[model samples]
Target: MKRREFIGLVGGAAVWPLAAQGQQAATRVIGVLALESLPRTRASLAPAQRRLAEMGYVEGQNLAFEYRAADNQEDRLAALVGDLVQRRVSVIVAPAGPPIVAAKAATTSIPIIFFTGFDPVSSGFVASLNRPGGNATGISVLHTEVLAKRLELLRELVPRAKSVAYLRSSTNLVSDHDRIGKLQPAATALGVELLFVEASRPDDFEGAFAKIVSAKADAMLVSADAFMFSNQTALVDLAARHKIPAVYPSREFAARGGLASYGTNYPEAYRQLGDYLGRVLNGEKPENLPVQQVTTLQLVINMKTAKALGVAASPFLLARADEVIE
Candidate 1:
């Protein structure tokens, strides 16, 4: 048997039946604070739940979740986080920078575990990566730090394009100044003019596309923000209708019909969140758990989307991709 299974079996033989009954009666609560809709957040959190289960945190027995989602309305995050704080949940897990900021503002005593797309230190999520020195700690997707790499990949996909548009959430603090500033140098070095297109709400997506078209951008790159990811379908559809070759932040976008994507595996980041939360539940302090940076980057290309957009995927680029969806 696997180590976890073996341990579960051995632990069950001793004090499980009786102790588990009492534990079931008093479930350890985990609050989920998210900016995405409940359905989307829950779907994204599956890997977390699986990881928790592997650590012997079985739902309805030893663990319970109190879920709250903003459904893309970022203003609702503060209220949702307040609700979790008032409930005094044992732990609060926040995904992405916005929710993490909200949770950090909500309570200092209530342990907060985050899975963010930007640098945790630069975003003020933690004091430092090696030592959080506070109650919030988890994984960082390093999206902002990878802007140049994403831009490089986009340039590779659209080599002859002289200009590129970066589609980002107007309200994304991480992408607005920091990531955009980082992309400028990369764009300059690549000999491509970079344009910024902002869409805060779902209603602004079309307007952003119009702005891109107005700027005469030859290609586009979607910023790695939760709000943008939640609206990937609409963004991908817009890119298709506008006939702009686009590169996204994750494989899910490519799988949803975008031209290509390059970034860290977020589901695994959530699993890391779950594992860290499990440790916190087992008496580890959040301050002691160093923030983790996701290092496993992936490139995904959709040959079908490339063909539909009349962009030829070089055989070499396809060979380097981690996955290619036909």
Candidate 2:
């Protein structure tokens, strides 16, 4: 039998049902603050829930979940986070940077576990990676740090592209000077000019693509922002209608029919978030739990997308990709 099942069996033998039920105070209530659809938010959180269950946190029994989503509205996150805080959630589980920032501001005492692509320390989420020294701690990826690498991969996909259109979100703070600024030097080294396109909401995607097409850029690089990630279906559709070869921040983009994506395995990062959640629920402080770093990167390419875009895949590049959708 599983450890949790065995423990439950053994514990029930010693304590009466009503007496044991009084221990519900020890149950963990995970408040998932998100900036996307509730269904999508819950789906993304499945990995974390599974991991927590392995550590004996069964949803609706000894564990519970509270979900609040902004539905892609950046301005709504603060209010949503406030609701979670008002509920006195045991811990705040947020994905990406924006929600975490809101959750951090909403409550200083609640433990926060995040799955972000941006640097946590630099974003002011924690004091340091090795020692968080704060109530907020979790996992981060090579997101902003790997901007140039994604550019390099895009260049490989379109060798003769002289200029590339880059998407940036006005709502995400993590896309500040520290992160987006690296693109300048990267584009310089790759001999490609960057045509920056700014889009803060769903309505702006069409206009951004229009700017890219008007600029006559060879390709596009979608920024690694939560807002953009949540609204990627529309973004992906626009890229197709505009016929722009684009490189994305995660494998989900490629799976959704984008040309290419190079970045962290999000599910694994969420699993790490689960690991941290388990630790915090088990009486460990967030300050003592060092922030986990996402090291597993996936290079994903869709041959179908490549064929439709008329971009020939180099044998070397194809071989280097961790996954290719034929």
TM-score of each: 0.91, 0.91
Model 1 CA lDDT for position 273? 79
- Name the regions of candidate 2 deviating beyond 4 angstroms: 1-23, 171-175
The RMSD (Cα, Å) of candidate 1 is: 7.8
**Tens digits of lDDT, candidate 2, 1-326:** 99999999988886876676686776778899998788888888888889898988889888989888888776898898899888888889889788988888889998898888777877789999989987888888888778899999999999999999989886545446676688789899989998888987788888888889999999999988777787878988889988999999999899999999999898888877888898888889999988888888999999999999999999999999999999
RMSD list, candidates in order: 7.8, 6.5
Model 1 over residues 92-148: C-alpha lDDT tens digits?
Answer: 999877899899999999999999877788778889999998899998877877889
Clashing pairs in 1: none
